[model samples]
Target: MTPRPTKKSPDRGDARIRLLEAARDIIRAKGFAATSVDDLCKAAEVTKGAFFHHFKSKEDLGVAAAEFWAETTSSLFVNAPYHQPADPLDRVLAYIAFRKAIIQGDLAEFTCLAGTMIQEVHASSDPIREACGRAILGHADTLVADIEAARQAHDIEGDWTAESLARHTQTVLQGAFILAKAGNDPEIARESLDHLDRYVRQLFKLTEENKC
Candidate 1:
């Protein structure tokens, strides 16, 4: 049986959104190759004809799914509470803590949609892989501002640019998901995120008192 990835469903007649939602959830639980158009149609409760009307092929759906995931998730980060902190450094740490706090339930529930898809199909599906890459890097760009601000305010001189550090968060996160899946526990992923938090703290040269 295909994993039931989500309970949310779009309103009737919104076939495209249903399919896209189904694609995002199911593809995370099941690899892209293992997740078929029929699986998506069944999860979406949409007929095959309806699926075809919106997407010409499963690969097309995959591309659209990656884009949809980017749009939806990027919006979430934009308004997240972590950005509320006044200090840029505090915001950066809060961002990492926010990432840590969300690790719960089944691996599929918390793991990234784009990371899961590209990990499996990057070799064979150029369009889907590129779409996933954009989704990942696009989100990484959001952190650059805070990281750059923190670096400038602290006069933190280093070879690393804020852009590279921002992308590293994704690298560590995607790796964390893989490790979590392999270890069969969500806590395993949190362990990696903990290391990330400490690493960021060290870079900022925060003492024990300043950390608070």
Candidate 2:
């Protein structure tokens, strides 16, 4: 009987994914400006030839990593309980609750990769900055749509617009994540959300009056 030819494993594809994951970690720990192709290779335990084979340059890898972060994390927000709430305001509150849970539970120590990179690289690397900008704006749009839905659902009266609320929510959350990382305390994020929750209450009351 003739021996069947052996099939090669798909190690190259796996290596590319490994390099991506390692790049995320390294960039998260050391801002994009500080991270280098050599650092990524060492983190992934791969060679320069392999890294270059998968990515054209360090900037190329940064762009890919930013896209990955957006796709993955934005899905989390889009799929969370925010959209399924009983009403619009409740839905927005639910989104905050979702973030609070992330802080207290499984996602405790991990700061937001997109937010971190945006703060560090938005003024510098155009590709990464653009990617980060898209991620932030996409997430904000989702939140804004949710807020608009709630405004219609509960018939709330308010002077504020959904766009404003969404932008405010995103900024507060991003700032909280930074403070949490710096202080090494997840509660800091939750505490920031508490203030946001209070602001929501005031807005809700104003909306009830149609003063907005």
Candidate 3:
């Protein structure tokens, strides 16, 4: 979640913000099915009344949390250094490098909340699942312009479109997070991204030094 503007209360304004923050962290750690309204209330230090005041139900809050995840992470990537490169291929590689660089903290800290939530609730709740799908695909869509530009610049031909390749990055990332969590090692995630970086370079016929 974005930084809270103030430490105000539910009645004073910020109950909704607190609840979304609590849901993002706790849901990533515990899975959406396992995280209850009470758990969120306790984590946010808000009461049941406050939670319901902000959200009609836990499912409602789940959807809101996914939207919140998209908003905050979108801001993070928009201002990221990867976008500074003049070469589209360089920008793509830098994106992969940036993903690798940020895998330095706890699983919940760096892993995606939308990815985690969707895996748990996709089968049961359409609303939450759709929210997660939007968050994941929306972020993936941001990469399409760079990927397509690189393809065009190199006159590259492939069976894949920029849209599919962009989504593939998220696929690799989500899988990498799962493997890292299962093995309790962040290196596993980094290794997966290394392979993703190589794949992108190979697709564009670019050498390591070509990255700007």
Candidate that scores best on lDDT: 3
TM-score of each: 0.94, 0.83, 0.93
Model 3 weakest 10-residue run by lDDT: 1-10
Query: Following a full C-alpha superposition, what root-mean-square deviation does model 1 have from the true structure?
Result: 2.8
lDDT of 3 by residue, 93-173 (tens): 999999999897778878889999888888999999999999999999999999999899889998999999999999999
lDDT of 1 by residue, 144-199 (tens): 99999999988898889999999999899999999999999999999999999999
Give lDDT for model 1.
0.88
For candidate 2, which ten residues in a row score worst on lDDT? 1-10
Instruction: Tell me which of candidates 2 and 3 scores higher on TM-score.
Output: 3
Worst lDDT run of 10 residues, candidate 1, spans 1-10
Q: What is the Å distance of residue 157 in model 3 from its true position? A: 1.2
lDDT rank order: 3, 1, 2
For residue 187, model 3's alpha carbon misses the true position, in angstroms, by 0.9
lDDT of each: 0.88, 0.74, 0.88
Order of candidates by TM-score, top first?
Answer: 1, 3, 2
